[model samples]
Target: MSDFLSSTLLFLLQASRMTILVSSAGLLIGFFIAVAIVGACLSHIPWLRRIGNLYTFVFRGIPLLVQLMLAYFFLPAAGIHVPAWVAAVVAISLCEGAYIGEILRGGFLGIPRGQIEACQMLGLPRLDVLFRVEIPQALKLTAPSLINEAILLIKASSLVSVVGVTEITRTAQNIASSTFRPLEAYAAAGLMYLVICGALALAGHYAERRLART
Candidate 1:
């Protein structure tokens, strides 16, 4: 039993590397996409706002599992062949970007009108004001929520298994099938997820404290 448990843990630890890689890639890409979406939604142009709204609605409404399947299967059928990992990352990015964009929009809305007006009155360029003042304040205001979203994204990454990526959940399933110990296999997987998410929460807490001091 000890041997079985030890070996199972080793295998799971190996598979978890893939999970971390995919989730990290997805979150990074999603964050950039979210910035673009927030810009479009906040744009003065009617068409740009409409497009941004449409993107948010469609991506948020669709199930993430369906999106993953479509990215992995449909893209190839449409002649855009991508690796399973690439498809998984892209699907995760698009889905998470929509949610993150909405979160950022709310953060932006929370910013004081007076501060923005002050920047304008001081003759700061729009880009300078946005980058230096608005974005920083918005990020600080939204840090906790953003960390929650990151935790959610890490959990949701299990769905990437369907795309043939052997992430932690997929590895656990495989172990359960072979070892006939579903409980042990799945419990270990759950524990791994808990550790990763707990670390993220701790990091976020530290960041929030630093921001508070500054």
Candidate 2:
């Protein structure tokens, strides 16, 4: 490899590591929020349902970069001192959680009313029905959308570079600055992202097949 290619490879590796870590953490957090939002959406209480809907609308309407900027820049003005990584994670989770919540809500809607009735007739508690009977099927039904969400999460990690997280996009930017070869550096970084997303797409397909077969 030429010197430029070699340096780009090294930088890409470093950036990819951060992408994995940040995406994992953000997804975990988003999953938690998704659960809560799903519960809220399904609640009997009107207030809770409205609150969940409002939350969904607000987060979904805002661009992710704006959310990140608010967390990184505006939060401190309001006395919340968050590190760049923490802010990045929070922003990504909030933005993604809104969409995930909607996906889960769609999954919940796909469940037949008769199924819930069946669980109730069997004397299963509501929570038990949700966890054991409902959510599992919903997950299977929503697997494709969730996998798409995962792909979005992977791409969104690049935005964190703007907040100075030194993730893949940031690394690419740095390499381009030093080597004056934006095309090579950014192109390599794009390829790295493409590979990660392609692998994830395959995993999603395999998971869907397994779920369907079972």
Best by lDDT: 1
| Cα lDDT, model 1, residue 25 | 93
> Tens digit of lDDT per residue, candidate 2, span 98-145?
999999999999999999999889999888998888889889889999
Error of 1 at 138 (Å): 0.9
Clashing pairs in 2: none
Our model 2 lands, by Cα RMSD against the true structure, at 1.4
- Over 1-214, each residue of candidate 1 has an lDDT whose tens digit, in order, gives 8898888889988998999999999989988898889989999999999999999999999999999998999889989887898999989999989999999899898999999999999999988988898778888899999999999988999999988999999999999998899999999999989999999999999998887777
**Which segments of candidate 2 are over 4 A away from where they belong?**
none
Give, for candidate 2, the lowest lDDT window spanning 10 residues. Answer: 1-10
Quote the positional error of residue 156 for candidate 1 in Å: 0.4
Query: Model 2 TM-score?
Result: 0.94
Q: What TM-score against the true fold does each predicted structure earn? A: 0.95, 0.94
Clashes in predicted model 2: 0
RMSD of each: 1.3, 1.4
Best by TM-score: 1
